[model samples]
Target: MPQRPEELVELLPAANRFLGREAEVGDPTERRGLVLVHDLAGDFDAAHAGALAGAHLLAALPHEVIARFDADSLVDYRAHRPRMTFSGDRYESFTAPEILLYALEDDAGSPFLLLHGTEPDYAWERFVAAVARLVQQLGVTSVVALQAIPMPVPHTRPVTVTAHATRRQLIEPYPVYWGEMRIPGSVSALLELRMGEAGVDALGVAAHVPHYLAQATYPAASLTLVEHLERLTGLHLPTEALREAAEAHRTEVDEQIARSTENVAVVAALEQQYDAFTAAREGTDLLSGGEVPSAEEIGAEFERFLADQDRKKPRD
Candidate 1:
């Protein structure tokens, strides 16, 4: 049987055992009392953005440390299972889920929780129950989940964030807007629900990134979420470095777009759709809906483009 989360934390190997690996622990006595978790899969760029933001916040808070999980420790027995109802290919790998725990130093306010990763392969409800048990063991008062959402917004504009909380009364004081659409089930969503049921405050912040740029790095979106975190948690995080990196990335993207006529044309078409959607949503409390292309649509377009390119390849 898997050990309890508290027991797992105790079992964590010391830094010395990992050689190059080291733990960045803030003042162990200060007690900032917060945790942040994020997913690190699907669209590596977006996942990278969330990870960067989480690392930056941990650095600024003075007493928070990055949560480390032993990915190798997870054991999933269903690795070779078919991917979908009609698919025959098996999954590449499978492992057990890990709960990473970090200690917040410096008497810094309530605990924050962040989660990032691709959709889980197992039961989300069970995952949430496990997280709730872990939270109780960690003595966390609140949890915050952060996610990066690819949208139709332009890269030139500042990324916007939408938030959702289990209890409106707890999060109403913050300058966050409620999510306009229904979010499907995921480990993070299940965690939030379980946290609320356990009487631990929980909220989710989703940072928007331009869909065209989802394949590329977008540190600007990361910085945007960091700013929101500072406001919500009363912790200051330095974003100057992130801003500079984002600007550099934007320049590179612009240069690449300029060089590729096909990409330029696609971007232009996307821009027109974005403009129309934005205009329709302006001057009202109603938030933009259905502006972002679904994952299926993006995948289909990409597959078709790839097929065309393959056809154009020279005969060997």
Candidate 2:
């Protein structure tokens, strides 16, 4: 027998309360409609920036779990095994993986939804359909995904991002850097694609983490993600804690890099590239000379670029 989409999730009574209370009092136009923010696919995130952002919001805001997904049916235990504490010969405790939906209140007392935790390992289509059903039932109007990717950028420079949306107008202010390319996919990416096909407003940002710090905890990237989330969703989110952590981490990283002349030289080279690009922001290309490559030149270079991007490589 095949599995049904409805079986994938269990909605709690609190979800109705979330809708019922809003329906009773708020003005129609004042409602921006609920925004569903997700940080799924743990391994896909560079430096776990998306997870950090979701965690920060949950920690800072008042929230409650409104729905739970069937993790056993979705997650592969071998890939992301749950932790077990064994004392002597007996097992004391086990930390199980879960996919949960949280209803939260931001600093301004506005309500929103967050889907956090493990991404599914199987039945992506069914999982996505289940979410779409929930979205309709919960009155969510837009979806925003939080992500981070390693880039050849410098920590000394301000963080930048690749902004994308289902509709171009949603992110008209952001620049488009790439033409067309096929890359590896994750469940979260698929969800965004399908949501757009269903005519829902979907947009997201992938903060550019310095490639050297891709495997490490980079609060700066997470902070940048939160800031973009605020601007995109019209939600007032607090970032003071993330800001403080980023500053402390920067000082620590700078001190470490200063100890190595080779590392310092590498960072200095990146800074030069970053500065050159900033000086010519109005220009189209990254080259400071302002020379646009021909179609043939771009194709050849892009082929070489594709060769360098092995998904299994140590650095992105």
Candidate 3:
């Protein structure tokens, strides 16, 4: 669907607020390059990991807020209840929604923009257009948005990422999507599409999260995103914190799988399917003689195994 003429210009006011704080943004020598956006979306809390990755970068680089969005118009207060704390005799303030634009610089002194926001419940188009306008004003050359999606893959296999971009050259290294797919829309998706239409370069990287680990914090995916960004933008970004966390999480997951033979079997089966899929994508004939299992079949078997394990567990 195309946006109305008024919707495009109406957001300029909010976007102008993004450029007004240049003094607080960063060093004048750092030239604006890319804009990284993270909208809390999908399963596996990958959005949280992406946000933490952004935060870690901000900690290492000089950064400041460029703009702030009004939560009252975008958020549903009832769904996100702010917690109140008591300190001494005074009541502490509630935790409000944080929808912010941050101006940051990398180790190479190339500046970039990072936008982190709670997925809005209202006026998504307006919010997205406002961000696009801000990107144009900031002289950002490219936009990279991060998202993590749950797939029927195993944690034992290396995490795969799907790249979407306005131009084919930007994602030449990644596998091309051939089939038509439809999923629930997100602000990040809209922003990328609108930016592309506005003649701005935009790319989206979707980290594949194992369906079973969708609810867990997977720092491995976070580390992968940081590394990919470095290669894409040629900017050195920090990933030590996420790396350490990923190693610890890997150990925990391994121990849990070791406890259950069923889990181990399921993982092994999934690993085979993953390897076959990988080989196929690489234009290999590794699975020519053997039968390649469908993702649905693998996912169904794992689900049954989990159900059986749950039923056998002692109830409280």
Candidate 4:
């Protein structure tokens, strides 16, 4: 386990200065829960959206603010290294904050922790293990993890959510869309495994958003995940703001699609592929190796599709 900085060691003592000493609005100790979120690649817009959605959920429910840790304050030592070259030896080092943590008092009076970070130099396994240990120490009852998945689907459609739980019994009411017998590179996957090993209940929800719009628009996926969080945690989130943002994103995409005939055609094709993929997954009880596409393959396909569209466009 990584050693905690002296600053984190004095959390309870620093609580008054950090979280304010005002009386909490609401306290619910019966059904305590915790939520963990991460923007794995540091997609700034996506992270902002996720943060907004999280804030909305927190505001709607009777929960107390516990502790918040900014990722910018957590230093990364792995990025700092001395380099040696044949021509000359030089020291090349860079330092940046690694992870952020937010502790919330849930309606059930349980502590919910939210985590986000920039892409780390080390493997996700190490990070997840450390977080699991922290959760164990905090005695968090249930953990909910959220993420956004960039997909070929159109932004005009409703965002779809896929969920995985450490224990099937914990998520009995919700639909079980997918599971990985072998874990993947996503931090959520590793953390789910660690949570199970530590006897902490954990669930993950991945919101699917149109890949084309992910860079320029992200609030749609954020709102979608927020809705799911409300359902899972029994918390109400004010979606008016997010809904407006999503509608604006839709209008922008509509204008772009109308202006370009090639883009319109490409979108039509993507819609078909999206529908087919969803149907295939829905019809299958189990996932096979052939059903999943590697991240590199997906990226390549997106590039090829965009290139072909560019080639078909009228030259200036």
Candidate 5:
């Protein structure tokens, strides 16, 4: 039987035994920032972005594992069945999810903490409590959450980022979301909310992904997240890898659009709507009076167009 969340939280300190081959160095005391990159809610673009950032951060910075959370308590193993890699005819090994805490340093020797792991299936409160305590113990000045959301935007346009923070000061001078939205909750969302109530500074960066490409590995979205992090935290994180990946992915997507006139038309229509909406933001609230094309309407049109194209394809 899987352990309960609270019970799992109790085992965090000793969870290092499950990290497989990854060596865990003890925590460093100089950490100043905390970045939360929990992969839940099944948003692939956000996951991709987090992965890219994590890779660069780990490669360029000095880091050590400070804490490990119990996967038995956090993950729903039945849903995410552990995979067995085939070494030979009958040899195999189990691969399990792990939650790890790392103390990292940037170019200027500034300290930061990265909490990278799978989002738990239960015990949200317990998880938040553990993270909050870690934040306080590490003297973390700010907590930043990274995510990507499917938006009614176009790929041809600049990616838009929706910013929010527990304290207005943290996200000021950036585009803030005031519209009432009811998104499915994520671990990072709850963590930020709990931390805010406890007076810890918390900020959220949501990269706006095109509805069509939300399920794909969108490196452009990843780059946007990294840029926002650098702007907010002065991390000096490298972006060359993400940049190259983005260009390649863009070319691939462009090729797909070129295959069908319907696809090209769909993209053009989305671009038009996006440009108008963005221009309206500078003057009046175009979204309030329903004067513009509804995001749902635009998305439906895009979907219908793609479906029609699929239906016309000759099956082998």
Candidate 6:
């Protein structure tokens, strides 16, 4: 079991170029303009939007694994069991969990880093430290965290996002929603906070997934996330496939909602709320715009809905 941050990850030969190492690791005065994007897989991600966006990037671009984290030390097997194949009385094969860092080239041949895989079940602080070390050693200029969150939003409208950053200027175009509220913590959020404290530029985008469809796959949210990433980082990523999936998903969702009068009423009410907030364009949240359920209220009402989705989920 690796106990130290340096030991937790193995940097492959492919990573040497980023380390400013020709014969040995040394600091370079020149900026490499490297960006690191991390999307740790966990229940915190509503509708698995972050994971899908990361997957899409890997599929569309050229990349290579640069580092491999010690998953055995970080993961709790009982919490997320590994997959194994069985045939009668014989065990055939087992698939292990992975936390990998990849070095990828954008469409314009610009280089960046991507850290993706299951969220750690242990040693979160150490894991974060290890990544921080990598960011400094590999000359990463910025770190971006991709996330998805449930909100009282309607699928009929364009997807919305909550953008955040360590510094105000990094997310100047984004609106400031609420003052402060306590919520469940996730590793990605913590990383952003810590990175900010370290004087390193870190930012994140939380795509709003409709609270009602939080349990189901929503490609629109994923597409929106990727689009925002492109906007923020100037990365030319392919979104055609995700766009098609979202379009097809919208039609299916509409057909299903049309069958249920209750569901239709719910959507209409949400749409009205959405439109009112957009028209008035208040600094306050949608809930304060008028007498409609707030995102927090709707989320609380549907809390029970997502609870079982995790309990019923099969071991990884």
Q: All candidates' lDDT scores?
A: 0.55, 0.80, 0.66, 0.55, 0.65, 0.84
> What tens digits encode model 6's per-residue C-alpha lDDT throughout 89-130?
999999999999999888898888999999998998999999
Candidate with maximal TM-score: 6
Task: Show the lowest summed lDDT stretch of 10 residues, model 2.
Answer: 285-294
The better candidate by TM-score, 3 or 4, is 3
Model 1: residues with Cα > 4 Å off, grouped in runs: 1-47, 58-70, 73-99, 104-127, 170-184, 276-316
Best of the two (4, 6) by TM-score? 6
lDDT of 4 by residue, 127-156 (tens): 565566555444456777776555556655
Q: TM-score for every candidate vs. truth? A: 0.62, 0.86, 0.77, 0.63, 0.77, 0.90
Clashes of each: 24, 0, 1, 6, 1, 0
Q: What's the CA error at residue 93 for candidate 5, in Å?
A: 1.8
Model 2 Cα lDDT, one tens digit per residue, 1-316: 6579889999998888756655564554444479999998455577788999999999999999999999999987776768999999899999989999999998899999999998898899999999998877777889999987666778887877778899999887777765776556778888889999999888898777777787788898889889888888889999999999999999999999999999999999888877776776755432112222234543444344334433433441
lDDT of 1 by residue, 136-190 (tens): 4444456776667665566654566666778887556434423244433456667
Question: Please, what are the lDDT tens digits per residue for candidate 3 over residues 1-316?
Answer: 6443234332324445345554245664453455665545322234355666666677778877767766567776665555688899999787877677776778877667777656676788877776766665566768887776665667776666767889978877765534554445677888789888988788867666676776567877777777777766677777788789889998999999999999999888878887776766675332111223345653454455345434644454
Q: Show model 6 residue runs off by greater than 4 Å.
A: 21-29, 282-306, 313-316
Overall local distance difference test of candidate 4: 0.55
Q: After superposition, how far is residue 191 of candidate 1 from its true place, in Å?
A: 0.7
Which 10-residue window of candidate 1 scores lowest in summed lDDT? 14-23
